[model samples]
Structures are given as C-alpha cells and as structure tokens.
Target chain A: MKKEKGKELVAGLFSLLPIILAISIFLLLLTKAFPLLSLKSLPTILFSSAWQPQKGQFGLWPFILGTIWVTITAFILAAPLSILTAIYISDYASGRLKKWLVPVIDLLAGLPSVIYGMWGILLIVPLVGKYLAPLFGTYSSGYCILTAGIVLAVMILPTIVNVSVEVLSAVPADLKEAALALGATRLEVVRFIVLKKSRPGVAAACVLGLSRAFGETLAVMMVVGNVPLTPTSLFSPAYPLPALLANNYGEMLSIPGYEAALNLAAVVLLFMVIIFSLAARLYLNKLEQRID
Target chain B: MGSRQKSTDRRLRRRHRAEAGFKLILLASIILVAIILSIILVTILWKSLPALKLSMILQTPGTGYYLGKKGGILNAIVGSLEVSLGATLIALVIALPTVIYLNTYLKRKSFLAEVIRLSLDVLWGIPSIVYGVFGFLLMLMLHLRASLLAGMITIALVELPILSRALDETIRLVPAELKEASYALGGNRWQTSTRVVLRQALPGLITSILIALGRGLGDGASVLFTAGYTDRITTSLFQPVATLPLAIFFQLNSPFPEVQERAFASAAILTLLILIISLLTRYFGRKLSRHKVR
Candidate 1:
C-alpha cells in the first residue's frame, strides 16, 4: 500500500506537468501581449497593415494574410497529391513497394526544415525566377508566396500521406470486398465506398497538416521574401507570423511596444494552431468511435 | 436488348479508362515524392563531399573558421549531442510516467485521459517557434542566460508531446492478460506496472526516445534563441551552446562560397546522423519484438 501510494503521488505529479506547462505558456504569452492589447483595440491591431515597430504602429494584417496565403496555397498543392498517393499505397501497392514507399515518404518529414530551405534556395527559387515567372510574362526573385507554398507543400506532404494512409487502412475490409464481389471494379469500390466512408478522416488529416503549415518558421522564412508588405499576388514577397518573431525578437527591446507586438503574434499563432489541432483530434476521436 | 447491351459495354470501357487515368496519376504522384526525397539527399551529398574533410568532424573551428580557413564543426556536433540527448532523457522521465498513469491508473475512455491526449496533440501541433519565444521569455523571467540547460529544457518541451503520444499508443497495446496475471499473484499496481508494463513497452519506449532525440537534434528554431551559439565546446550547463541546424542556417547565408560549402557539410553530417538514428530504431524495433508477450 505504501508503494502504491508513492507511485500514485509521483505519477500524478508528473502528469500534471504538461497541464501546468500549457496553462503557464498561454498565460505568459497573454501577459506579454497585454500591453499591445491595451494600447490598440483588437480590430485596429488585426485589421491595420501598418507595422513600423519604431513608430509604435503594430498592424498585423499583412503577416496574418501572408500566413493564410502560404498555408492555403500549400494545401492546394499538397492535398490532392498526398491523397492520391495514400490511396495508391493503401489499395494497390505491393507489400515490398509499400514498405519502401512508406519509409521514403516519412524520411522527408524527418529531414530538417533548414535542409528544405536550402533546397528551396537552390532549386525552387531558381525555377520560379528563371522559368515559371518569365513564362507568365512576369519577373520575380523567386522568393515569394508561391515559392514558400511549394516548399511548405513538400514539407507537409508526409504528414498528410501518412495520416491518410492510416485512415484509408481503417476502412473495414469487408466493405471493399463486398463492393468487389458485386462486380464493381477495384477503383470503383474505392471511389464509391472507401472514400465515402473515410472522408472525415481524410479531412482530419488535412486539418492536421494545416496546423503544421501554419506555424512552420525557418523554411518559410528562408523562401517567403520577408518583405513585410501585404502580398499583392502569388509572386509578391510576404512575411509570415513565425518568421516575424524569428527575425525581430533579437532586437525587440529597442522599441516601446515591439516586444508586446511580437508576443501578440505568438499568441495569435498559438491560438490558431491549437484550435485546428484540437478540432482535428476530437473529430478523429469521434470518427474512430463511430466507425468502431 | 441489343441497344442495352451496347450501352453496358460502353459504360464498362469508360470505367476502365477512368481507372487507368487515376492509376497513372497515382503512380506519377508517388514517383514525384520519391524524386523530391532523392533530390534532397543527393544534392546535400554532392555539395558537402568536397568541404567535408576528416578534420572538419574531428577538430573545433580554428582562427578564421567562417573565412573558410581551417577547423571542423566539433563544437556544434558535440553541443547538439549534449542538448538533444539531455532533452531526450528529461522528456523520457516525464513522459513515461504520464503515459503509465494514463494507461494504468485511468479507466479506459476516461474523460481525464481524453483531455490529456487532446492537450498533447495541441502541444505537438504548436509550432516550434512559439516554443522558442516561450523559452526566451521564460529565461528572461528567471533572469537566466541562454545556456545548454535552457536549450535542453526548451527542447524537452518540444520532445515531450511526441514522446508521450508515441508511448501512449505503445503502452495501450500491452496485453491485459499480463496485468491480470500479475494481480493474481498479489502484485500491486505499482509492481505490475513497473515490472510487466515497462518490460512489454521497452522497444516502443526506446524507439520513441530516439525519435524525440532526432526531432530535438534537427530542430533549429526553438533552440535558436534559447541555446545561443558558442565557438568552443563548453561542458557547463549554464554556458551557451552551438547546434547543427543553426550552424547550417548561419553559414548558408554567408557571402563566402567556402563557408556555404561548410554549411552543406554540416547538413550532410546532420542528415547522416538522423538517418542512422532512424535506421537503428527500425532495426531495434524488429529485433526487440521478442520482448512482447504475444
């Protein structure tokens, strides 16, 4: 009984650590962000595009929109490709191919973001600058919204593919077998039955990917041009929220509200990411229960 | 009947055509992802081959290191090991207990367990940069300088969610019969958990730890502000440390070609280290399945 009591006390204390950490992090960011909030109304800070930290102007509209643009474009590029790859791996690929393919895809995720940034610098920037842009009768330095999106797409591909593959695998085998037995082709069975059943799971996978893309810093920073202006088009240079903090945090104390402004950015970034992730987690949980 | 039969054949041809088209697209997507992965690996290897001298791995940076004069990245390499390995150890101690308590002490499908899992998922989802900022603010609050200990603690937070989630799934797979057998012998929950649960979950436990270590080693943003960079290898917990990710980020942006080459060298070295860790986990996972009761 004594041993049990001690174990209970220790484990209980340890488990509460995460809870405490989460609460404290939120509170700390909030406290840091309070000065910005008190100085500017929420709408003025959120809707204004002015961001001269020296001038005490702290509008985050540009960065906020930049994050949205990059994340959305990345999903547009990644989602279809990832879903198709997942479908093929789950339904058609041979065992040996599946083994090889799964590991290779996962290796991309394990690669450091800096490496991806380097590749972006070496390949995508040049491709966009030299070829894709000029082909459209436009010129770009190639570090723009589209370039970041392409790189970010590659970064998030594994998350989507791995999760989608798992979700597809969870579809009851008998449903597919029954569809096959009824003279439906394999592809037809997948489209009509498996896809229909696992739609929510796939959506959850994309949501999970969105959460990752929203907060990616170094890779996007390296490629996204960091011009701090509202991106006017796909090829326009942009600055994202995480990149904002990364580039300015070192010298934030030079200005009056600079520290609070950056802290508010962190607050906003964390809030969006947490909402998306929590929703996906809860939805997946409910989906699992329903399917089971 | 002849017309109906003809239409049926037409529909069959269309279905087959659609299937073939999708098949082609799927194959193309898979090939594209594979090509991307290979391109990254090949490019890093090709660029780093010339700059990656034997001494680069063996010796610390000498005078004019950034000028491409002499010396290896011994300090950054060693510093990465200290921070990530230390973080992994710290994360493991905390995560193992939380996971055990969740699986053993809590009822299946309990609300508290669900809430904890949700919180972990959110924590994992939060970007590494936020953690960096948080770590920086935390250091400021405590009036501590950027140091190895601060970096380890920060990275430990980053690794905690990954470790706990990985462990939660693994521990849940332990056969219930083993627990019951222990209880039948009058083994307390404490004894049953430590002896049986820990043993059965050992392979997964180790794999998760290594995975967390890999993440910490590869991360640059969270440690960027917290770890702070230094040239010489210092053993003190309070001293600033260098890491491979920041090394790559800083060097690649330099105006000198030689320095950029060293960045690639660092990339190549870091890549090889992570690959080895993953390959080891795969091997151990296969070899250690013997420990499982089933």
Candidate 2:
C-alpha cells in the first residue's frame, strides 16, 4: 500500500510538468509584453507601418502584413497541389506506387527548414531572378516575398498532404460504393461523395498548414529580404514577424523598450499560431464525429 | 430522341477525358514535388564540392573563415551534437514520465488528459523563434549569460511536447488485455507501466526520441540568442557554443565566394548528419520491431 501510494505521488508530480511549463511560458510572454501595451496603444502598434526603431517609431504593421501575405501566397500554391496529391494517393494510386510515394512525402516533411533555405538561395532565388520574374515584367533580385512564399509552400505542403491522405482514407468505403451503385462515374464518386465527406478534415489540414507557414523562421528569413516594408508586389522586399524578431533581438537587448517591442511581436505571433491550431483542432473534432 | 442521345454521349466522352486529364495533372504535381526535392539535394552537393575535403571535418574553424577565408565547421558540428543530445536527454526525463501518467494512470477521456493534449498541441505550434525570445527573457531575469546550458533548456522546452505526444500515442496503442493480464498477476500500476508498457512501446519510444533529436539538431532560431556563437568548441555548459545552422546562416551571408562555398559545404554536412540519423533510426526501428509484438 505504501509503495502504491508513493508511486501515485511521483506520478502526480511528474504529470504537473507540462502544465507548469505551458503556464509559465504563457506568463513569461505576457509579462514581457504587457509593458509595451502600456507604452503604446494597441491600434498604433498594429496599424502603422512606420518602424524606425532608432527614431522611436515601433509600428508592427509591415511585419504583420508581410507574414499574412507570404502565408496566403504559400497557401494558395500548396492547397490544391497537396489536396490533389492526397486524393491520388488515397483513391487512385496502386499499392506499389503508394509504397514509393509515401516515404518520399514523409522524408520531405522531415527535411529541416535550414536545408530548404539553402536550396532557396542556390536554386529558387536564381531561377526567379533569371527566368520567372522577367515573364511577369517585374525586376526582382529574387530575395523577395515570392521566393519566400514558394519555399514556405514546399516546406508546409507535406503537412497538408499527410493529414489530407489520412482523412480521405478514413472515409467509409461504402459511401463511394453507394455512389457508384447509383450510376455515378469514378470521378463523380470521388468529387461528390469522398471529397464532400472529407471537407472538415481538408479544412483542418489547410489551417494546420497555415499555422506552420506563419511561424516558419529560418527558411523564410533567409529567402525574404529582411527589409521592413509594406509589400507592393510579390517581388517586393518585406520582413515577417519571426524574421524581424530574430534579426533585431540581439541588438534590442541593450536599447530601452526595444526588447519589449520584440516580445510584443512574439506575443502576437504566438497568439495567432495558437488560434489557427485551435481552429484546426476544432475541425478535427468535427471530422471525428462525422466519421463515428 | 436521337439528338438528345448524341448530346449525352458527347458529355460522357468529355467527362471521361476530363478525368484522365485531372489524373495526369495530379501525377504531375507529385512528380514536381519529387523533382524539387532531388534538385535541392543535388544543388547542395554540387555547390559544396569546393569545400568537401576530408580536413574540413577534422580541423577546427580557422580565423577569418567568416570573411571568405578557407576553414572548417568542426566546432559548430561538435557544439550542435552536444547541445541537441543534452536537450534530448532532458526532454526524455520529463516526456517519458508524463506519457506514462497519461496512459497508465488516467482515464482516456479525463479532463486533465484533454487539457494536456490541447496545451501540447499549442506548444507544438508555437514557433521556435518565440522559444528563443522566451529563453532570452529567462536569461536576463536570472542575470545569467547566454551559454550552451541556456540553449539546452530552451530546446528541451521546445522538444518536450513532440516527444511526449509521440510516446503518448504509442502507449495508447498498447493492448488493454496485455495490461490487464499484468494486473491479474498482481502487478502494481508502476510495474505494469514500466515492465509491460515500456517493453511494448520501446521501438516507438526510440523513434520519438530520434525525431526530437533530429528536430533539435536542425533548429537555429531557438538557440540563436541562448547559445552565443564561438569559433572554438567547448564542453563546458556555461560557455557559449557555435552551431551548424548559425554557421551556415552567417557564412552564406558573406560576399566572398570561398565563404559561400563553405556555407554550402556546411549545409551538405548538416543534411548528411540528418540523413544518417534517419537511416539509423530506420534500421533500428526495423530491427527492434521484430521483438515488438505489435
């Protein structure tokens, strides 16, 4: 009885570790960020694009907008491709084909973002600068929002594809068979029955992709020119929140109020990511219910 | 009636063609993704050729290496291994116990378990750069210097969720009857958990640890400020240390061709390290799964 009781006590203490860590991280970010809130109004901090920190202007609009632009552009590129890939794998691919494809996708997902950054610099940037930008009539050095978005798309594609594949596979086989029995073609069954049934899971996949793309640092930071600007074109230079925080925090430590501003940026980034992930979870819950 | 039948036949033909075309397009996308991945690997390997000599791995980084000078990345490699290994160890201490608590001690639908799962999901989504900033704040508050120790602590926080979640899923997969059998044999909860559960979950636990290790090794943002960079390798936890990701980042930014070559070389080295770790994991997983009942 004593041993059992001791085991329970130990287990209880260890289980508190995650809760404590989560709460402490939240508190740390909040405490650091609250001071900046007192110093500046929320609207000013969020809306103005003028961010000359040396002259005391600490607006975050440019970074936030940059983040949104890059994330959206990546999503636009990745969603269709990943969804189609998932559909092919789940509904059409032969067993042998799938055996080869699944491992490749998994490896792509596991590849580090730093490696992606390297590839962007060596391949995508130059390709864009030399070939693609001319077709669009834009003069790009290639270290721009477009390059970052493309790399980010590739980095996050596997997440969407992996989730979508699992979701589509979980769809009841009877539903597709029923549609076929009603004189529906293969395409119709897939489009009208399977795709419709897996909509919630697909939405969750897209949101999860968005969350990951929004927070990616090393790859986007390396590809996107770290210039603080409101992006005017896909080829225009801009800085996202993660890049800005990473580039400036080392210097910001010595300056008054600067570190607080960086912390505030992190706070914003954290909240946005958390919100997206929660929404994804909510969709996943709905998907589970439908499956049941 | 003849005209209507003809129109329906035309529509069927067009729909069939469309299906074929869409399948081709989907196939093209998969091929495109594969092509891009291969091209990345090829380009890095090709560009790294100039600096891929044997001595690069053997010797420490030379002075002025960042200024387009020729040198090696040995220091950064050692530093990254030490920090990631240390962080993985720390994360294991917390993750293993928590996973056991969740699987063996609590009901599956318990409120605390749900909350932990939710919070872990949130933590998994939080960016590594945010972890870096948080670590910076921690160091400042404690009046401690940025060192290898700080980086390990920060990375442990970053990796804990991933490791715990992976192990939790594995534990959840353990059959109820097997666990019940242990209970029937008069095994206490701890004994059942450690002896039966851990034995069954060994392969998965190793995989999770390797995954966390791979993630920890590849990350640059979280360690950027916490582990201050150095040209020389040090084993002391209090001392600042260099890392491969930072080495690649700083080197690639320099305007010198030679320095840029070193950057590509370092990238290749990092990629090779990750590949080796993954291959080892695969081998280990296959070998160990023979003993795993499920």
Candidate 3:
C-alpha cells in the first residue's frame, strides 16, 4: 500500500512539471511585458522603426522588417539547394554513399552557431565585400543582410535537407516503381511521385527553417552590422529583433521603460515563433496522415 | 506520320537532357554543402594556428594580449563546463521525470498530453535571445545579479524543452509490450518506468542530455546578459563567469589581429569540444544498444 501511494505521488509530481513550466513561462513573459503593453498599442510598438528609448519611442518595425528580409532571403537561397540535396540523398544516391553523406549532414546540424559566425566574419564578409557587393553596385563593410542571409542559409540548409530527405524517402517505393513501369524515367519518377507526394513535409521543413532563421541570434548578430536602420539595399546594415534585444538588453535597465520595451520585443518574438512552429506542426501532422 | 515521329524523338531527347541537367544540379548542391563544411573547418584551423598553443589552453586570458601577447582561454573553458554541467543536471532532473510522466502516466492520446507537447515545441522554438531577455527580467525582478547560477538557470530553461522532447520520444518508443509485461508482473507505473522503460531508453536519454549539453556550451545569447563575463576563475555559483562563446564574441570584435586570432582559437576549442561530444554520443549510443534484445 505504501509503495502504491509512492508511485502515485511520483507520477503526480512529474506530471506537474510540464504544467508548471508552461505556466511559469507564460506568466514571466506577460509580467515583464505588462508595462509596455499597457503603455503602447501593439500596432504602434510593432510598426514604428524608431527604437530610441531615451526619447520614449519604441517602434520595432525596422527590426521586424529586417527579420523578414533576412529570413526570406535565406529561405530563397537555401530551399532549392536543400531540396535538391534531399532529392539526391533519397532518390539517387547509392546505399554506401547515402550512409557516408547522411552523417556529414548531421554533423552540419550539430555544429555550433558561434563557429558559423566566426566563419562568416573570416570568409563570407571579405568575399561579399570584395566581389558580391560590387556587382550589385553597393559597398559594404562585409556586415550586411546579404552576408547574414547567406550564413543563415548555410546554417538552415541542413535542417531543411534532413527533413526533406525523410519526407522524400517516405514517398512509397511502389509509387516510384509504378511511375517507372509506366515508362517514366528515373528523374520523372522522383519529380512526379516522390517530390509531388512530399510537398506538405517540404512546406513544413521550410516553415521550420524560417522559424530557425528568424530566431537565430549569435551568428546573425555577428554579421548583421547591428544597425537599427531600415535596409535600403541587400548590402546595407540592418538589425533584426533578436539582435536588437541582445544588443540592448544589458544596458536597458539604466533607461526608464527600456527594459519594458525590450521585454515587449521578446514577447513579440515569442509569439511569432509560436505561430510558425504551430503551423509547421500542423503541416507535419497532415504529412503524417498522408503517409498513413 | 513522319513529322509526328520526328516531334516525338525531339521531345524524348529534350526530356533526357532535362533529367541529366537536374541530376547535375542536385549533385552540385550536395557537393556545395560538403565544400562549405570543409572550408569552415580549414579556415578556423588555419587562422587559429598562431594562438593555438598549449599555453593558450592553460593560461587565463590576460589584458593587452591583443598586441601579440600570450594568454589562454582557460577561464572561459572552465566557466563553460561549470555552467553547462549545472544546466544539464537541472534540466535532466526536470526533463527525465516530465518525459517519463508524459509517456507513462498521461494518457497517450489525451488532450492534456497534446497541449503539453505542443507547448514544449513552442518553447523549444523560442530563440535563445528571448530566453536571455526573460532571464534578465527575472533577475531584475528578484534583485539578483548576473552570475553563474543565473546563467545555469537560464540555460536550463532553454534546454528543458529540447531534452524533454527527445526523452519523451525515447520513452514513447520503449516497446509497449515491455511495459505491459511489467504490469502483468504486478509492477506499478513507477516501477515499470524506472526499470523496463528507462533501461530500454538509456541510450536515447544519454544522447538527449548530450545534445542539450552541446547546445548549452555553444549558445552565447542566453548567457550574454545573465552571465557577466569574468577573467578570474571562480567556482562560486553566484559569481560571474566567462564562457567560450562570449569569449570568442568579445575577442573577435577587437580590432587587433592578435585578439582576432585568440577568437579563432577559442572557436577551435569550442568546435573540438562539440566534435568530441558528437563522437561520444555515437560511441555510447552504439555501446548502449549492443545488448538490446530488439
């Protein structure tokens, strides 16, 4: 009887952990942000690009736009390549090659973000400064949206490829065989059967990748030039929401309402990511159903 | 009929060409990813060569080393281990139980479980920077200063979702029959989970913790405000700590070439640590599964 009571107690305690955590996070976010939310309209806070705390102005549009620009640019650059890589791995590669290559992709996923940032500064900055920027008739100190986008592209590529590979591989073998039996070529089978069937999963992969790129801080912070301006060109310095929060949070307490504004920004980011993740999960569930 | 035959031949040729072109593009993209990885590794190694001395590993970072001087990242290295280990332990304690409960106690298809999992996923997706902001606010509210303890707590929050999710999946995958067998033998939920389920999921649990550890070690944003950097090494949880990621971030931003070299060296150290953890995860993962009856 004592042992049974102990079991019930343990189970109840453990089950409360998740509930407590969820409540705590929600409460903390709201409490920190309450002052800001009370003072400013959400639209004013989100739409205004001027973030001068001393002047009591906290428009977050520049950072929001910056985040969108960088994420979209990264998505455009990475999606095609990742999808292609996934296609190669799932539909074309021999068994031995697939075994060798998949681990490398996993390694890419495991690499630290700071290292990616370091590489961005050492190689990507200079390369863009010297070659890529000039072609577009812009000058950069190597810290710009383009460089950040490219680095983000590299960072998110593995995620997109990994998920896409799984999705493509799940395209039933019979589908491909049936396509080939109907006189379709190997590429045709992959394009029509594998690629077509995995669209929802691929969409989920893209949304997940976007969420990652949006939330990424250290690496993007390193290369984004940390400027709070609306970017006029790809090579112009821009600051995203994560970068702003990181760059300013340390000194925020010294200024009145600064901390509150920063907290509101965090709430904004939290909500944005929550939405994207839910969408991704929704699509993934759809993909699961389709697979079944 | 002759004209139709010629058109069909042309279409066939075009389709074959398209296939070849598509294959080539796919191959190039794959190679591009491999090339980028090699480039990053080579560049860090090459740039860090000057500062990658044994003393650099042993000595604490010193002031004015940017003028071609000698100093090591020992403080940051030790600090990273201290904070990450603390965070991992806290996260593990919370996560292991939550996941166990999620898998064993909760009804698998219950709305509560679904909501919990979804909440965790959303939490996992929230960026490290947001966590830093949240931690900063918490520290302010509680009248606490940025310290090792604060850093550990913040990172624990960051890592909790990840570890719990991974652990949840691992525990969920513990063949249902094993749990059923335990129940048949008069074992309660706690006993079955603590024994049969945990033993089967040991490898995965280990891997999940390692993943969290690796991420905590690499992350700089969450600790940027919560863990004030310090040059002096101290074991006290309330004191500030320097971390490898922050070290690299601060050092690389210095204009001096020597300081930048130190940054690269710090990155190399961080990279090496992550690689070792990856290898260990693989090695232990294999070893742990070797005796499995499955």
Candidate 4:
C-alpha cells in the first residue's frame, strides 16, 4: 500500500510537469528579452505616447488608447441590448421564444471571428463609407475606430447575453415574488429585486465582455484601418496593439527588437485580460460566499 | 372617493403602459441582434456567389489572380484537417488524465481543485494572439520552424483549458454511488474511473471533444505565425501547410476579384462545417443532461 501510494504521488506530480515547464520557459524568455525589470521600462512602455520602433521609440499609449476606446464603445453599444434581451428571456418571453432566442445566441457565440471580419470587410465598410460616414462627418473614414467598435459589439453580444441570462435566472424567486406582492410592478421587481440581486454576476459578465473585446484580433484587424497612430475622433484611423502585433510580427522575425516589441505588446494584452478575468473571478467568488 | 379611485386607476394604467414599453424595447433588441446575424450570413453568401466553383476547391495557389484557377484548395483542406485533428488528439490526451486525476484521486483536495480551476480560467482568458507569440518564441528556441507540429502544439495549448474544464464538469456529474459500487466490488481507482465513471460520462466527453474540435477548426490567428502558409499538401508533421482561414486571410486583402471571391466561398464552407459540429455537440450536451436528470 505504501509503495502504491508513492507511485500515485509520483504520477500526480508528473501530470503537472508539462504545465510547469511551459510556464517557466515563457517567463524565462520574457525576462531575457526585456531586461528592463531593473530599469523601470514598464511604465514608459505603457504610458509613453510614441510607438515608432524604427528609431527605438516604444510608447504604448496609442495602442492602449485605441484598445480602451474600442472596448468601451463596444460595451456601451452591446450592454443595454444584451441586458434587455436577457430580461426578456428570463421574465417576459415564452418557452417558444426562449427556445429560438437561446440557440441563436449560442450560434452567434460559435461563429468564428474570421467570419465576423469578412462581414465587416464586404458589408460594413462599403455601407458605412457610402452612407453612415456621410452622416457622421466628412472627416469619417469608413473603416475607423467606430466601425471596428460596432463590429466588436456585435461579436461580444452573445457572450454578455449568455452570462447575464444565467445570472438573472439564478436570482432568488422568493425575492422577486415578494416584491411583486408588495404592490411593486414587474419593472420595479426587475430593476430592484432581480438586477440588484444579480449585480455581481452582471458586473462579471460586463468585465468578461470587455476582456473579450480587448483581446479580439481578426475582426478588429480587418476593420480598424491598421494605422499606428492616436485618433482624434471615432472616425479617425487607429491601430490597436493586437492588430499591430498580428500584422507586423511575421515580417519582423529577423529584425532585432521587433520580435521583442511584439512580445511586449502580447504581454500587455495578456495582462489586461488577466486583470479583467481576475476581477470577475473575485467578484463571482464573493457572490458565492454570500450565497453560502 | 370616486375621484380618488379614478386617479389610482389612471396611474396604474400609465404604469402598465411603461411596462409594455420596456417589453417592446427588450423584444426589439433581441430581434435586432438576430437581424444583424442574418445580414452577415446573407451578405457573405451573396458576395461569394460569383466565385463558387468546383475548381476553386480543387485548385492550388495560382500565380495571377485570373490565371490562378488551376489548383483547388484540396491541399489546404487536407492540411486543416490534419493539423486540427492532431491538435485535438494531443489536447484530449493531456486533458483526460488531468481531469481523471482531479475527479477521482484528488476529489478530497478541494483547495487544489479550486487552484486548478482558477488557473484554467486564467489560461482561457489569455488571448490567442499571445499564445501565438508564445508558440513562436518557443519554436525559435526549439528550432522548430513554422511547421504543422508547431501549429498543433500551439492550438493544443489554447484548447487545453476548455477540454479539461469540460471533462472535469462531466466527470463531476457522474454519480458518487457508481464509483462507490465499483470500489466495493474491489476495483482499483483506475478501473473504477475507466469502467464506471467514464462510461457514464461518455456522451459528455464526446461533446467536449466536438467543441474542442470546432474551436480548433475555427481558429486562424493562433496558427498564423506558427504554421506559415503553404500551397501544397505534405504528409510530414514538420512541414508547413496552409489552413482555410489562413488562405482567406491572405487572399481577402488582395485586389483581385477572383481571390476575393475564393475567400468568400471558403469562408462559407468553413462556417458550415463549424455550425454542423457545434449543433452536434449541443445535441450531445442536451442528451447528457437528460441522462443526468434520470
């Protein structure tokens, strides 16, 4: 029995060996490429305004600004729609409506980002340039921050709706019923009882949606115009970090510090995603604790 | 009293109208999302119609935009199949044992299980582009060029978290009584997991694999840097090959109509394949849920 127990422990440790090795190798490479941990390059890399790699200029402000703008724009457009749809499905919709709506939402989630990019290219660019851009301003380029933001909003809608529906559905039935019994209207119950109860979950959903938008590459790449400069307006051309990395990395294979710069951008993107997910995870954990 | 009663009635009616307005807005939002999705699909199909030909699928990468119609995408199709399948196989191999160990041997270790879950969550949250860069750097270090093996490994890393989480959830749903029965009959831990728990979770496991497969097939950016696009099919795992998405990515930006049309047709085919896989997995997921209920 003792020998068998020893073998099991060894096997268990062996299972973890691959992940540990991968993580270590990643960290080692990152540290070697950017030895600026001792020189305080992170703040300059993140907060500086310029990002020209030709003359050793490496400011991430434009990339950061573009990423934030696109994600916030997407969130503003998608959140209310997704939340409303979730409310409809959970409260007002019948079984038939739910059946159709749920599958459609899932199918949306399953569609590849490339398809979204293709749609943006063949459909959105032309329509926006010819019609919507004129209405916005003569300053509008058909493929700008706003166009990419709108497409990203559509891409992230299903994620928000799915999470929001799960959260709203899990709201305690008794709380909602009690509100209804106290002469509260259905809207009041939804606003006060259900929404308030599921606040953490809704927040988690929003953060998750934001993370997805932030990390999105293909869809945004196709529509964002790929100009590596700060934008003056929603209609102005802009380049996001992911798009820059995707477009330039392959060509920069032999260029000194180019691969490093791409890796740094990736590290930044990873950090942003991790922060959002970590916040969401913590919020969910707190919610679970409260329920417990 | 009559006036007061009338005022209350009026207020209630106004509130009802507001509620109805809210519902209308909610319904409109759902309909709008659906319309957008349909428009995207319709637009893609409509635009790609001019390029829909058997030759496009059977031709190789041609020299000129118009004269390049000689070779079909048979090679790219085969390449995608092989790489994606290879990645799926590797992911399943890695995830299955980890999930089995967690669910069976380490069931009592709740802290460890939570840590694993948290790590997996973080892994999933990490963007595919980052995985691409990571894989690229690793390939450089290992001297593994942009080959199918490198691409498969990168995809395996991306798909690992999803497969493991799905497997873990499915394994957890297996009734404790079944494991207890197996143990009572003098079966060992491995035997119990393989014979009893896994047998019960087979449908769910299959669903997980299908989801992973779909995800692998859909991914393009992760493989872009790792699997440098090739025009011809090669049997060796270390050779470079093109995938459908990669082909679309490269071709869509070209000014030629033929190239653009081919991109559209390829996009449609990829979308159809993914949709079919997604539906099948969902069906299996529902089946597994029903079995659990009983």
Off by over 4 Å in 3: A289-292, B1-11, B66-68, B287-294
Error of 4 at B282 (Å): 2.1
lDDT of 1 at B194: 90
Residues B104-168, model 2: lDDT tens digits: 88886799877777777778888899899888889988887889999998889889888987788
The candidate with the higher lDDT, 1 or 4, is: 1
**After superposition, which runs of candidate 2 have C-alpha atoms over 4 Å from their true positions?**
A180-183, A285-292, B1-8, B68-70, B284-294
**Model-by-model DockQ, in order:** 0.78, 0.66, 0.67, 0.54
lDDT of 4 by residue, B20-89 (tens): 8887788798789889989988887887787777876776666554344555676677778888899999
Q: Highest TM-score, which number?
A: 1
lDDT of 1 by residue, A1-292 (tens): 8868998889978987888888888999999999888888989998899998879999999999999999999999999999999999999899999979987886787888998998898889999888999988888999999999999999999999988998999999999999989888878988999899999899999999988999999999999999889988888889999999889884557787788999999999999889998888788878766765
Write out the backbone clash pairs for model 2. none
How should the candidates be ordered by lDDT, best one leading? 1, 2, 3, 4
Highest DockQ scorer? 1
Model 1 DockQ reads 0.78
Candidate 1 interface RMSD value: 1.0
Interface RMSD of each: 1.0, 1.5, 1.7, 2.4
Q: What is the TM-score of each candidate against the true structure?
A: 0.98, 0.95, 0.95, 0.93
